[model samples]
Target: MSKTANAGGHEGSAPHLHRLVLFSDAVFAIAITLLAIEIHPPEHWTSIADLFGQMGHKLWAYAVSFAVIGVYWISHRRIFARLRTANGVLDVLNLVVLGLIGLLPLVTELLWEHGGAAAIVYLGLVTAIGFALAALWGYAAFAGELTGPVHRGEALFTLARVAIAPGLMCGLIFFALNHAWGLILLALALGAFIAGGRYMRRQAEQAVEIDQPEEASA
Candidate 1:
């Protein structure tokens, strides 16, 4: 049970991480609900098919955006689980990340309304903010060395997982020049990230094992 707060601004009595998680849950719920609102009801039978057909892109955009956001949240949780405490910098960075996440509904709406070009911009913005959060986490972990000596490799692996996002988004943006093909690339990137995370976890475990043996011998 760790307590944290925005040490730079607040009295440091409140737990910032818990607050962030609760706030994040609220925003994500609202954002997801907003996506359903984007679907317009058919005015008549004749327009029903047209409305439904036109919504394909919007639905796809919503699904993709939601999935990416979910992935980021999961990754954030995994990284933070290793920490014994949170610092002001990490709190600020988490706020920034959550702030960007709170904008997902609007961005998703924009992509649904405007299409691929808009999606590229929205995706870039989201990924950049996530990258910043990851950087801040890495910095905090390095600065505090909060995790025990055996857990340093876990920190590095977590950092590597975070680094993959911006790079993947950059590649997807470049490929999205082909529109639908680009969206496919984005999906592929997500798949690759899932696989990469599993691999990194195994590597981290191996590193822990190696370090343990040396420590034992000493």
Candidate 2:
């Protein structure tokens, strides 16, 4: 009787888990699509140079927004990949993450329009998203049933991955204060992201190695 009940419960949770991941994926897709839609070509340009010059900043902003959204989407996928089940609190946190993601396009527009002055808002939004993601991961990790056995190193590394955006953005905030800093901070942010990614990958590899020996001994 207990075995039957356990089996039934697992069956029921499977669909719920699938739906949660699907819904999150849909939100990510829409947010990234909206980013491109926010960019428009110049209405009246005398020449190719004029067209390129006019659209330059918008194009740059679009690229930055696209990359940021793309990274979060990948991170989201990683989080859900380990998840075995979802709870009400997890659902709420997921919604919070999605809500922040949905706002990226508007923030991107703001950054393009007002330049450095608007960067604080943009950075702040990104920072919030980062922290939200970290919180979501933290909750899942704490609730043992929501995920399979999470490796200690992997958990710490995942936290670092989510922290990269907020940490770097906070530093960039100081630079964003000066209008003259312009795209330099954007370039620096991207560079830091790349470096951070490499570091995280190494950490993940080490985590797997650490886990494997323990599992084998067990």
For each candidate, what is the lDDT?
0.67, 0.78
lDDT of 2 by residue, 1-218 (tens): 22222342444557777888899989889988988888888789999999989988888778778878887888889988887776667778899999999999999899889877887798888888998998998877764347776666667668766856654754454456465584588677778767766776787778889889999999
Q: What stretches of model 1 exceed 4 Å from their correct place?
A: 1-16, 45-49, 148-154, 166-195
Deviation (Å) of 151 in candidate 2: 1.6
Candidate 2: Cα lDDT at 19: 87
Which whole-number lDDT from 0 to 100 does residue 154 have in model 2? 64
Question: Residues 1-218, candidate 1, lDDT per residue (tens digit)?
Answer: 23222334443323655676677677667767777787665555457568777667877777777766777777776666655555666667777777777777788788878876685677577767567767866766776443334355556666766766754765575467568788887888878877866777787788888888999999
Q: What is the lDDT of residue 99 in candidate 1?
A: 78
Residue 71 CA error for candidate 2 (Å)? Answer: 0.4
Q: Judge candidate 2 at residue 7 and give its lDDT.
A: 41
Residue 101 error for model 2, in Å? 0.5
Locate the minimum summed-lDDT window of 10 residues in model 1. 1-10
- Give the Å shift of residue 16 in candidate 2: 1.4
